[model samples]
Target: MATDHDIPSPCPSLRDRKKAATRAAILDHAERLFEERGYDQVTGAEIADAANISVKTLFVYFRSKEDLAFADTWLIDAVVDTLSRRPSGTSHAQAVGEVLNQALRTLNPDSGGLDAFHRGFGESEALRSRLLRMWADYEDAIATVLAREASLPAPDPAIRLAATQLIGIIRSCTSDEVREYVSGFPGEETDALRGWIRQAVEQVDNGLTRFLDRTSQSPGI
Candidate 1:
């Protein structure tokens, strides 16, 4: 991809500038095409055409139509990095909060070119189903990493269950908050939504604590 000469200010580094340009071009076209035909109806070949790149190059950037699932999606790496950057004494659940909040905030309702993307996603059952699958994938990855950090054995079923609950709570809470805001409810409604999220996080911690406590008291796993 060519440099983003349209921007008045120069990017800090040429490498970053080029990479951003390529990523932006691909997403711009992807979003447009996705909005045009509903996500499932759009093809990668169409995306490549819209982005003025080869299909191979487009595939190099994005693996699937499902990738257009999120606007400027950076969940996997960004969430991991966010968790890693938390200061000492930040609880694991709070670290999770920071990761999710940082990831979602970058795509606020006012973001340009995103309104259509949100409309497409919100109105399409196919897109919603695909998002659920992606969410499951994300939760599984998070659970695997959490298991490693907590020194649990591979394929830790407990970690997976906790991760599933966490993911479910997050999705439900966020959706409820969005519903409240759209309905022009008071800020307190959103506050309640957050309270529920905090409760969900606390429940995970409590469950983990109980598990460790039981293991300590027991003779074997």
Candidate 2:
């Protein structure tokens, strides 16, 4: 008789795999189309048609065209998940820096879809606004994870401030100005960008500690 520990995990069912494949097809085709044309020039129906799925089915996966356009924004979700799973003794800065370094390693400077996505933000005010809102949500998610790790209550002021500062460092590293400079460059430029990210993370780690110490030492009365 097999014990519970001996039991193997079940794989996804055929139907579920097909659903995943379809979703990927939609996103891949949508990105290609958005890159070829502009975000505003592409319509949900067009993307659906290109993906060989009906518009209704496309909506089933994504709530709006903008959602489909920004599908890869899950980088924020990945960051929170990574931070949540860091080793127990890892410092906050180390956890965040490791997660960011992993992301940097995966960056493909030659990816046309990435360039187009960045261009999409530049071309549309609405997209920029949506991206700002998404960043706020990302910061909140990071704060929640940090609070849990520190055993603090949700919305803990210190944890929130730390999360905001870390997110700001990440944003600065990948801002439009930086992207424009490095997007079309060779691997050497990408390496330089990675170096800058490492430096920024180090600065935040040291700067935050000093600031906290100063605040604690100041007279409250």
Worst 10 residues of 1 by lDDT: 108-117
1-221 per-residue lDDT for model 2 (tens digits): 89998998899999999999999999888878777887888889999999899999999999988777677765677678778777766656676777666665666655432233354433676777777877788799888887776565775566677888878766766576767666556666656666667777887887566433324644331
**For model 2, the run of ten residues with the poorest summed lDDT:** 112-121
Instruction: Report every candidate's CA lDDT.
Output: 0.61, 0.72
Off by over 4 Å in 1: 1-23, 32-46, 54-63, 70-73, 84-88, 103-119, 123-125, 173-196, 202-208, 212-221
Clashes of each: 0, 0
Q: Give TM per candidate.
A: 0.63, 0.79
Candidate number of the best TM-score: 2
* Model 2 residue pairs with clashes: none
> Can you tell me which runs of candidate 2 are displaced by over 4 Å?
1-4, 87-90, 112-122, 180-187, 210-221
The global Cα lDDT (0 to 1) of model 1 is: 0.61
lDDT of 2: 0.72
